[model samples]
Target: MPTNQIEVLGHAISNGKGVQLNLDIAKLHTRTKIQVPIIVERAKKEGPTILITAGIHGNEINGVEIVRQLVSKKYNKPECGMVICIPVVNVFGFLNQKRQFPDGRDLNRVFPGSPRGSLASRFAYHIIKEIVPLVDYCIDFHTGGDGRFNIPQIRINEGDEETLQLAKVFAPEFIVQTGHRDKSFRHTLHKLDKKVLLFEGGKSLHIDDAVSKAGVSGALRVMQHLGIRDFSKELESMDAKIKKPKVVKSSSWIRATYSGMFHPFVKLGSKVSKGDVLGSISDPFGYFERNVKARFPGYVICINESPIVNQGDGVLHISRD
Candidate 1:
């Protein structure tokens, strides 16, 4: 790899150029190989490279759509930096319409993976080895997993000022300061001194048009703030509004007490106080009802979209100061 050239998915993209390439990961039981698409837009001048990854979980399609919209419509060879967009990271999960790999592993939880590890692990290793080392920033898009719906928001590591500032540029409705989890892409990138912003919106396996719109605009705003895109002239020309996303330091999930049909009273983005009646769970016969209350004061960031839930199922996610 030279200073003026970048290689991805076996394609060498030189300065002032863009290319769509594919990297083959492995051969399935059917002897068919799986490959992921990669799009790189390199600038002619010296600047940073921002990596935008989506669809790590196959079911999280809103982010995938957002990346599609950006790369297809909004992206250009940056005036300064470069843009690397990988619209679908998990080929198996996306094809199977699943959140986890066929082997029951969460791809997002297997970062800096082993080259000779499981399918998910190998994919993670490939990204860490080939992609993560080349980028200065990362914007990973996601949605609420397991039948949950999330308000459009940006999730960042706790107390990271630079990344926090970038998240602010996106100006989603909420900015969550969460601790880094083990084997997560954000944590791994943080360890390498690369700032990664996790954008959470919509629901798994479904597309919300409004959420998609928000996601697309948020990403453009981030690029604008980074000097990769023109904000006022271009965004305003498209009637985009940049609002300040509120920051919430703490959050918790409300779980079901027993298996039943859950009827949620509060919706996503609803503000709640301690002991607020968030929802109710009842048996099929209308007996054995249990009220799910808010344990602390916070705003509702995520809610279960599915009516049926099992005992100990997370129904709502709340965020508080």
Candidate 2:
């Protein structure tokens, strides 16, 4: 509860000061040192402490960009509380452009891990031991896996009204009410009574300008709402189209019935009626083709951008009544 005892990576950071520390835990097969940089900023006055993190899945480039922009723009500097930004958590995977650690483990699936565990587990354990205790709230950014492109949305556990309100303040196109994944970073934080907003947008290995803007604007808005800083001028300049996030209580995937070239018809976050043509699949040759139709009325939250898909592949994610 002491304000003066703010230490990261064993270095003390006094009030009204900022520091850049590195988590150097492992080495590559070639003995190259990979350090994960963590940026910290604090205010003289005491307030909530929030940690902004990205790249749990290293190939999620848009998430990394969002946190990077926050640090480069000095948006992480708080006027009251403390702001900790870890732009890329899985430096190993990041360097290799992979979604998992070098040891073939998903960094997100191993949380609050053991020191003697696998490479990813050790990294998770270190983070939990050295950093997570200091955080009051967290915003973990991510993009869809593989070729799935997700509309900007905030995902939180159902029945957490406080977190729901914060998601509302984030103002993404949709707020997905979902259950927590076992051993996920969000799940670990939730157990520690830390509020976390899991942001999903764009797609792995690619960055979209609209997704970046949505992410940055949402973080600024959340920070302002938390009284960490005032971003009125910044937000106004961005001219972001802040949506009253539609709370998605339930959703379902529309899978492909045929295998072939995939072409989507509707835009991201667009609403459609049942039986609408969401996309089409055709054989590489002109021999076969089929149109995919919606089974229910809802907003399209995700679209598979892959040029080719197999039968039973989930081509679109739509909200359900």
Candidate 3:
């Protein structure tokens, strides 16, 4: 729907106005109220409404940082459409630097959630019911779970030509064609016929300057592409150069064979050939070591940065084709 008049978090927002609302759906066990701030900005000219969200997983501070930069730099203020920024969607996880809700549930797995379900589910339900309906397209930011560091990339389903095209416009380092999680926000939005660009970058609990730049620049490019605003001057000022994104059709993870201290050898976003030495695992005392080689040729998009590893732990993510 064209964004002229809309209501976000129960407040009516008219054209050319901005409002900050709190999604105070729940409180902590300490009885202290926690507010998930939702920032909404609408242009006088009616156009598509785009929802920019991050912090679905509380530990993914890189995602939160990306959205924060957008809001802080006023990049979310569009000239033709409505822009909604939810910098911290899962405040509970963010506050504790955890990955799940207070009820120990991953919020991303509970899309279109039940009002009568878990804490995460109820919050998810509210998001879909109250905010998502007004959104036309969405950019959900994320980062690698655990300690895996992902290069800047946009994840989309293989056949979504429109979203794939838009992902190209975002100009991240990579575009990964991957299936959606069963009940993820991306899947739910897809079911509702809303296009979503799921961006993955950096790692959880940490923020990288390059990744933040990529995330912000990509959003600017998307908004500019949609005619929501002209970011010509802003784009010129951005330091992260537009990447010729490599569309990854398939990918796989390189698991550690022997539990030991892990070290990755290849640079992220670089192509690798079969049998290449990607990394090594060794005993802490330097008594045992094993070289991890690439099984097939692909690009290294993610690496496990943790210094320790276990048997069968995924240490690197490489594209198959």
lDDT: which candidate is best? 2
Worst 10 residues of 2 by lDDT: 25-34
lDDT of 1 by residue, 70-139 (tens): 8778564587778999999887899999988767799889988999999888878988988888899889
- List TM-scores for all candidates, in order: 0.94, 0.97, 0.97
Q: Which 10-residue span in candidate 3 carries the lowest summed lDDT?
A: 1-10
Quantify how close model 3 is to the true structure by its C-alpha RMSD in Å: 1.2
- 26-109: candidate 3 lDDT, tens digit per residue: 777888776899999999898888999999999999999999999999998989989999999989789899999888999999
lDDT measured at residue 192 in model 1 versus the true structure, 0 to 100:
94
Kindly list the per-residue Cα lDDT of model 2 for residues 213-256, writing each as its tens digit: 99999999999999999999999999986788899999999998
Alpha-carbon lDDT of model 3 = 0.92
Clashing pairs in 2: none
Ranking by lDDT: 2, 3, 1
lDDT of 1 at 15: 80
Off by over 4 Å in 3: 1-4
Worst-scoring 10-residue span by lDDT in model 1: 1-10
* Positional deviation of residue 250's Cα in model 1 after best superposition, in angstroms: 1.2
